[model samples]
Target: MKHLFSVLCISAGSILSLSAQQTQKPILYGRNWMAITGKPLAATAGAMTFQKGGNAVDAACAMLAATCTMWDTLSWGGETQALIYNPKTKKVIAINAMGVAPTGATIEFFKSKGYNFPPEYGPLAATTPGTPGGLIYMLVNYGKLSLKQVLEPAMKMAAGYPIEAQAANSIEKGKEHINQWPYSKKVFLTHPGEKREAPEAGEIFVQKDLLATLTKMVEAESKALKQGKTRKEALMAAYDRFYKGDIAKEFVRGAQEQGGLITMKDLANWKPLQEEPLQVNYKGIDVFKLQQWTQGPVMLQALNILENFDLKGMGYNSPKYIHTLYQAMNLSFADRDFYYGDPTTMPKGPIQGLLSKDYAKERAKLIQYDKNNTNIGPGNPYPFEGKTNPYLNLLQQRGYEMDTTKRNFAPKHDLGKINTSSDDVYQERLLLGTTSIEAADKEGWVVSVTPSGGWLPACIAGETGIGMSQRMQSFVLDSALNPFNVLAPGKRPRVTLSPSMALKDGKPFLASAVQGGDTQDQNLLQFFLNVTEFGMNVQQATEAANINTNQLWLSLGGTKTEDRMPKPGQILLNNNTPSATREALQEMGYILSFGARTSGPINAIYFDWKHGSLWGGSSNHGEDYGIGW
Candidate 1:
């Protein structure tokens, strides 16, 4: 019933509310530019950059810095993966800023420690810091503003900013772990010996070490500029200092002293790569994602699988529609867990075959219309790539998927199949979150980035004020699980921070992303279908109720075999979902759990070429917000 068009804003009161559906927040319309992010303050940073005549890239970089500095579920040392639509080239470029596994990170090493995967937290779980280098790489190549301009908001926040309740609460929740690392304790615990160790809500929390680190980078850039270096060269000078100079030295020393494995060589050798992205055409629109190193392509694969079905005819959130979506997602994630990994590493997943339409049709055949397929596993995509299946023996050795009944108790009858408190610890890893950045301007530039890692409980490097990334936990320790993703030194993990882009009729159509780790692509896949197949506007699509399939190996958190295992037949749905739909899912083998908000804060922008304006959207899930003018 929501094919109604939306007029432009994020506040209440809508012109369409009288005759059509009403959304909690109104659409944000911008004639010149639009900036939407996970936090209102970060979005303000993007707006400030745009106001300074900076392009979308510059605004996005500023927001990235601000979100990291504010610790918006992420810190300055996390990974940054993005998709940029450059008006000049009229092509989408992928930025792979994900950090690589440091020295001593190997499957044998982790297994020797009596672990099935890398530890979930602490310095031992970190990779070489990637966010600072990533931010600089993006700013140098495509952004118009100087590093000083882009970092202003974040630097100010680092110096001293009023902390929000959400962040303060997170610090309190993680105080125990924060105390484990001296540097982290120094920065986060304002009242270490008191009952309330973390800062109170709205307190002017400051990070002097972080401020000094940021100032050092700025000083490096300023020195280069004064020496007659070009803007590009000056930016790279800052990048060098972070990765190869004093910053790198301090970061490596701090990490190693705290039992981390990162070496100065690892930091110096690691560099963010700018490469071509993979894409698929769905109903005439081209959807793009980063390479196999990320879980981004999973959305492209699901879109391909869903293309065979007439989604609109089944209707939105219909039982039949939900079933079909779950089935398609199931098939896609099966391949993702088994095959998706770093292409630069040996035993790389069959990237070409995985995205093939022909391959998708074959996978779709396994979807049973009547019952859930708990035994669903990876399909043979090698044949589609015109290669022999060398891992056939391994595939044959592994049979079926879920087997959690013995280790973990089932969810209560009232709660449905969604995992309950019994698996709360596991649930945290499956949904480890990140912040997203979506920026667009009238100049035809667009940037969609999903930056994560170095979350709360992170190990702060000494003097650097940088939190080491906990992304190493995303890697697999066995080839039998994911040959392409076997943990190794310098290899990137298959992360779930997926940013999205779409071009319709050879023009930029949409830029979208979400924050929930493994749920990022799943929510994004449906968010796109909401707009393209169901005709919902950007705002409505973002605010739309979505279902999450917990049928894949989680990309973050968890170390034991049982922790990484999937909860097949479990489904998470919006609380407002009709009883009939819930019953139908139960009948079809789904264990249904409900929540007021199932989505992980989807933020997006729809390029309204007809009106020559931008339409932005933020979900009702949490604190996500957007501004346009």
Candidate 2:
């Protein structure tokens, strides 16, 4: 009887443990994954291929190619960046397809033109285009399907497909820019009369030029291999066909006449930046990121800081949690401003402080109990081993609030709800919310990049596709402060495209990228918190309602800096948000910014081992859909 009792106890314990594990398992699974994008037709087609047993790479290739036809703003001539994780090799790879300034372009040239470099000058300040070369690299290296096979879906979509609501909406928002390009306008717009235009919704949009481009890409490998060239040689030959051959020469000549800077040599010398992936650890999980030239590292640094906190105890979307997040954001942005640049050019600066575990902990210490603290300072990296300055002392002083007996973890107050508007920022309070994670692996890595040109040269003026990047405008132009961000040739700009990833048990579990210019870090930080600390599923994490703090934008880059913290403590909120949340946020000392039209789409994917499947979601705000089979 004693032995039997012992056996029953042991059995009960085992059952309880298994049940706990099962509860923790993430819902949604598939060996293969599909995601819907803001661009529905493109996402739908990609989903179809996944249903046909294609991998992420194959799906990505098809989606990207198809997007050129569907999304005029995002095209083949634009840059491409991705971070990929390979489960087989337990590694991550980073790819930089960001374009560079042309050799002859000078700051003096723009100054001479009496232009102070606006935020987005597209064709006028164009750099070398990189997507075509990028596609070749992704297909030949990471993908399982042949170029032709991956491209089949894209070609079909280009030939004819009903325009999705999201795609149509995007086109409507960017219609002026689309119409600005004569070739683009001819292919996409339906300007039937003075005030009337063809409806993009449910209409068939064709891209004969893009289809021709894809056809050529497919032929290059086949024709070159027939001539006995190696794969690398054949690929290079294809690249030439893009930028140095007949199509390229015409493009260059047309662009030159329109005051564009790209030269034959710039195209010839242009090559994607390839390097090993950047990595850090969080709660025994290895977090991987791209280097600093893009803002991927910024997200990694923010996550590193949050790790020192008992974030789970803070509860989801609580006022305390959100406020603390904003504080951390301020600290991260401060570090980003002081450091974080092209490592080769800047060399051993403040960025090290940004990502150091000790520094992150110290910074985490600054979170306060009840006030909105935007003036947070930076934490030193080299201080005392095993821990950093701010967090350790702060945690000690705060008395480990995570201890259940001392405090309740749920949100204390209901601010109203989060809302949106197109005119200006509105403040509302609601609940808390959160891409696809960029994948890292043996074959190659995918990187998330936001390569924007503030000053675009006119493509219609025969500038071909050449345009200056508007990224420089992200820097503060004020001579009194932020002298480093002053516009100059070869000066990398401050950015918010925070591409980020996470690892579980030292292996890659999630990799995602985002493209919101001002909202990037805020979105990434919250999304990651949902997955790691809040214990939410990938879809839940991605779908959570998130607020944009815009630390750098508020302090340095936005249209109204002074109005960020409104007078009399009244803040604007997204009109779509609940009034109660807005009132609460205002009472708490926040000013709101609102806009119905949002920034770039946020994209993400995660692997759930418990269910033995993958889960993915795109921005609900975007017209794009998330697809998985």
Taken over the whole model, the C-alpha lDDT of each candidate is 0.85, 0.53
Segments of candidate 2 deviating more than 4 angstroms: 1-28, 48-54, 114-119, 169-181, 344-349, 377-494, 554-587, 593-602
lDDT string for model 2 (304-325, tens) is 7777766665555444455556
Off by over 4 Å in 1: 1-19, 400-423
Which window of 10 residues has the lowest lDDT sum in candidate 1?
1-10
Question: Model 1, range 1-629, lDDT digits (tens) per residue?
Answer: 11111110111221123225677899999999899999988999999999999999999999999999888489988889889999999999999999999998878888989988899889989988888988999999898989999999989988899998998999999998999999999999998899999999899989898888888889999999999999999999999989999988999999989999999899889999998999999999999999988888889999999999877766778777888899899889888988888998787788899999999998787777777877677778888989987876666545432332231332221112346433566556667788889999888989999998898877899988899899998888877787888888999988888899999999999899998878889899989998898778988888888998888777777677777677888888999987766766777778877777776689999988888889999998878889889
In model 1, what lDDT does residue 420 have? Answer: 45
Tell me the TM-score of each prediction against the true structure: 0.94, 0.76
**Deviation from native of the Cα of residue 444 in model 2, angstroms:** 12
lDDT of 1: 0.85
